[model samples]
Target: MADKPTVTIIGLGSMGQALASAYLEAGHRTTVWNRTPAKADDLVARGATRAATVSDAVWASDLVVLCVLDYAAVDELLAPNADVLKDRVVVNLTNGRPDQARRTGEWATAQGAEYLDGGIMAIPSMIGTPEAFILYSGSRTAFERYEAALRVLAEPKFVGTDAGLAALNDLALLSGMYGTLAGARHATALVGPERAAEFTTSLLIPWLQAMANILAPSSAEREAGDREAGDLPSEESPLDMQAAGLANIIEASRSAGVGVDLLTHLLTPMRDIIAAGEGDVLTDLVEVIGKEIRS
Candidate 1:
């Protein structure tokens, strides 16, 4: 391998462009390809090579990076070029699920490609900066080999050898993000459209940020609610407040004619758990979720 590796990038969207820039800045020889050639102009202007086709890009580099829309797009773009994929390290920074990652990894293995699934935890602006964190899973050697070039996207966190780990954690963090937005939507709707943005910027934003710190404490308390988990009994069980308050909030939203169906749906499973007499189980809410708590 040369002192600075050569990199080929597919998917020239905002995130892809950012990655390309980062790699170019780090002095890697960058070969870029986009579904539409126009998008590669800026990178080309910056001394990068623009490939006419996906196979050309893949064949030109030791590492082929993908930062496309999703796994579906990935499958569409690369599936036709399976013959060209042999003996290459394919790093997918596309968003997907654990199952998708594992399935895709298997497919890549069939093509004689070493697959590395990655989840980008940062927005486009943070790419290559210290603020971004990227999760990688698959071959440890692949992670180590491309660590320097990959650091352009974020701090590379090798999430173990499981190809599914990257996509799984990606889904996990997205759940929290969606939940936070869901709560924001609920709060903003409860307050009026005119006041919603103001409330989010002022009240709701800080409140949710506060939840970050208090959440760990309440998390423990929630776990204790599960008698099977042997939680210490407390006079003030949080379930009463949760069930009743959420019920009331939904009721209020209904009374005001605001659409709160989503929040109601999210809490429904939790409500069902509590009704099933798991009210004391703090972590019982995890059952409604798609993954276990990060803890």
Candidate 2:
């Protein structure tokens, strides 16, 4: 059998440690470094090498994985070792804006390294698990070459050759996740503390799961291509109906002394759609949002 590729992890934060552990457990020769130094002790004891400096770490492996504090820290660490980065594949999994990812990708390329900007969709504990998936964008060739070793960390999704795509999708998914959480919090508040647990466990979870299944297809269709602005499906729940329902929910929440801020975001767009006298479907709100975003 071919030997597993060597890996050098250049951060020792929770996610970085998890990445190093995954590679080490998969029988790869792993080298780890962190600014604190002591963070590499555990991995070093598990048959991994402890790099004395960032240069040593970069020079130790063909695949260099970075999960640092931010893009600025990434620059601070890699700049000094720029010469050692040549011919290596740098997988940056730092959290940052799309622009930052693209700029870092350019910097890595200028140093003669192949780059892959990564957006890890999992928490530290989920690394190497079936449920975890990390998005990758940039250098299709590099991704294809190191795909196997990368899989040791999580399921890798190659989004595109554009370095910014991974970060874009990452932030977009996070926005959706946070929006859902906000709605969940508002829902729980509406039900009062005594019933919150039961409501979430029994009603909210099942209802959300079912609604997600129904809504996903429509979302997918919209994303597949550019549709006419008014091309909304003739769904059962029209815009006026949804707007009225939302208005009532707001009123009820207000009367019950529960905050309606989260619910009002949806209501605002629905009201605009009704006032515009456009298509009547609830999905028509998508067009309203699209126009505002484009503007």
Candidate 3:
């Protein structure tokens, strides 16, 4: 019924521009900035004001939306102008680490500013959709203060006040995505690209999505340990099949003159599963996979 809010968005890359577009569409006065300057031209054409510099961008609004490369970039760019950012609610939608988040949160607080570390769960095109799972962690007060501006990007998923949970969760989800990708790469090679697309689009996508949904809850399930005490869904995928599948890729790559190092590295350890005779259970091969690579 009225003007939504005045927001400043820095780093006008694909994701950052998408954020600017969403805010503009939602009736917020959005001031945008980018290193190249030309990157913000399109956003400028969309009724968004392009700030002269990062300092001006920060000075333009009560909320600063940072959707940049990573947390390191945030520090490198904002450190000099930290004084201008004092007391502004900074909603960092950049990909980063939990430790980095805590460090950044402390730095922002020291400068008399508020910070919220956010993890984006959607692609650039899905910016304003409800399925875009946006994660925010940090000061609850800061998050509440700028919740509306955050919503201009995605379906805001508030992870808690821990200041690191969002990054941790973000990393976990990314690991799963990469894992699924690894499997697909191998499968495409095994089945041949011609047939790969058909199998992948029709079967792989749905199958992996279902597994991912199941695995989301199963992560907690395995932690609680009431579901018969074991590893991942071994009975379904099977360790022997998976092991053979991995081996087949390694062999095929050699024959096809392609590098299969990643495959070997990922699947080589599973030889123990086959040796242990639990090759029928896909879950048993994962006694060594740790939290470090899940995302």
**Highest-lDDT candidate:** 2
- Please give, for residues 1-295, the per-residue lDDT of candidate 2 as tens digits: 1488889999999999999999888999899999999998999999889989899999999899999999889989988888998999999999989999999999999999999999999999999999999999999999999999899989999999999999999999898789788888989988999999999999999988876665544655668754443454457778898889889999999998998887777787668768888768867777756866765
Poorest stretch of ten by lDDT in candidate 1: 226-235
Clashes of 1: 8
- The TM-score between candidate 3 and the true structure equals 0.84
What does candidate 2 score on TM? Answer: 0.89
Report the candidate with higher lDDT, 1 versus 3. Answer: 1
> What is candidate 1's lDDT per residue for 124-157, written digit by digit as tens?
9988777889999998888898787787668999
Candidate 3 lDDT tens digits, 184-288: 786677667789889899988898777666544365566776354423544678776787877876888888776686677657557755676644666655543
Candidate 1 clashing pairs? Answer: 128-152, 222-282, 222-283, 223-282, 224-231, 225-280, 225-281, 226-281
- What are the RMSDs of all candidates, in order? 4.6, 3.5, 4.0
Q: Give all TM-scores, in the order shown.
A: 0.85, 0.89, 0.84
**Predicted structure 1, TM vs. truth:** 0.85
Maximum-TM-score candidate: 2
lDDT of 3 at 212: 62
- What lDDT, from 0 to 1, does candidate 3 have? 0.81
